[model samples]
Target: MEVLIRPDADDAARTVAGIVHQALAEGVRTLGLATGSAPVGVYRELARRHRHEGLGFAGVDAFLLDEYVGLPPAHPQSLAEVIRRELAEHVDLDPARLHLPSGTAPDLFAEARRFERCLTEAGPLGLQILGIGVNGHIGFNEPGSSLASRTRLKTLTDDTRRDNARFFGSIDDVPRHVITQGLATIGEASHLVLIATGPHKARAVAAAVEGPLTATCPASVLQLHPHATVVVDELAASRLEQQAYYRCIARHKPARHRY
Candidate 1:
């Protein structure tokens, strides 16, 4: 994996946004999007490009990473709504093209199958955006999730619930479960870009970037991807053991692979 330590969160976001913009410019149509504070800046940067730079997403199709199981479709905290508010509303991306797993489906298992099928039919994602949770989870695939798991229902861990509770009025309002794209499913993307920032994410970023590839840290699975990029701010890279080496690698990146 390529580790890029930017000066700050905004710089990290721009680096990620540049990768997405380059992909779109190269005619990549499908995208895997993650929702959280980590990716909010990237989304805003993309939106700015769309408005001022004429960057367009006219025919692009985006698949969200996950959604809360019990939240109403219109719930402000729902991943779908979060994406709409942060990214879609600011660009030309069609609402119909932004696919998200159904959180309120009566038969959630069937919904998982259907959403997986939908993802398969849409063709391989050109890029998948990710955000690492404090516990080192990706999507909602918490610790102990099978490394080879597929799209499915997953119970939220207490740590995850507490982390997300800030989005809701209270911890009690947080959903207990979520439907997420598993590690195996996420690995299918042609390019994976994980954005992380803030001091709170330092340890998780270290585990994911340099720790062993175990199910205990689902984000660590990125280490196995042939084309994965971890863009982090200085605070998030604080715990990485090989920070100097990573910086050297970034500094001497070939011109053809500058993005």
Candidate 2:
């Protein structure tokens, strides 16, 4: 995994946005998107580029990473609605081309199979964006999730619910279950870019970028990917042991691999 530390969240977001923009220009039309504070800035920057730099996503086929089970699609806190409000609405992406798991399906197991099939049919994602949980979970794949798991229904842990509580009225309002793309499924993307910010993410970032490959830190699976990039603000990179080495690598990155 390549770790790029920026001075701050905005700088980090800009770097990620540039990677996405460049990919689009090079004929990448499929994207796997994540929701949460970490990626909000990246989405905002992309929106800005769409408005000012003529960046277009007209033919893009986007897939959401996960969604809360039992929540209505129109729910303000739903991942689908969150993505729409944050990025889709501002760009030229077609609603019909944006896919998300059916969170309210009567048969969630069947829904999981259907969504997995949809993802497979779309072919490999050009890029998959991710946000690490305070506990190092990716998507709704909580601690102890099988590294080889696939798209499926997962029960949310208390820590995750509490962390997401700020988005709803209270922890009680947060859904206890979610349908997420598993680690194995996420690993299929051609490129994986994970964004993390703030001091709260420092330890998790370190564990993911430098720690052992273990299910305890689900994000650590990035280490096994052929093309994975972890972009973080200085605060988030604080706990990483090889910060200097990562910086050196970034500084000497070859021109063809600049992004």
| Candidate 1 wrong stretches, greater than 4 Å | none
Determine which window of 10 residues in candidate 2 has minimal summed lDDT. 250-259
Ten residues in sequence with the least summed lDDT for candidate 1: 250-259
Clashing pairs in 1: none
* Candidate 1 Cα lDDT to native: 0.94
Model 2 residue runs over 4 Å out of place are none
Residue 237 C-alpha lDDT in model 1: 95
List, residue by residue over 1-259, the lDDT tens digit for candidate 2. 8999999999999999989999999999999999999899999999999999999999999999999999888899999999999999999999999999989999999999999999999999999999999999998899899999999999999999999999997999999999999999999999999999999999999999889999999999999999999999999999999989999999999996676
For every model shown, what is its TM-score relative to the native structure?
0.98, 0.98
In order, candidate lDDTs are: 0.94, 0.95
Q: For candidate 2, report its TM-score.
A: 0.98
Give the distance in Å from residue 30's predicted Cα in candidate 1 to where it truly belongs: 0.5
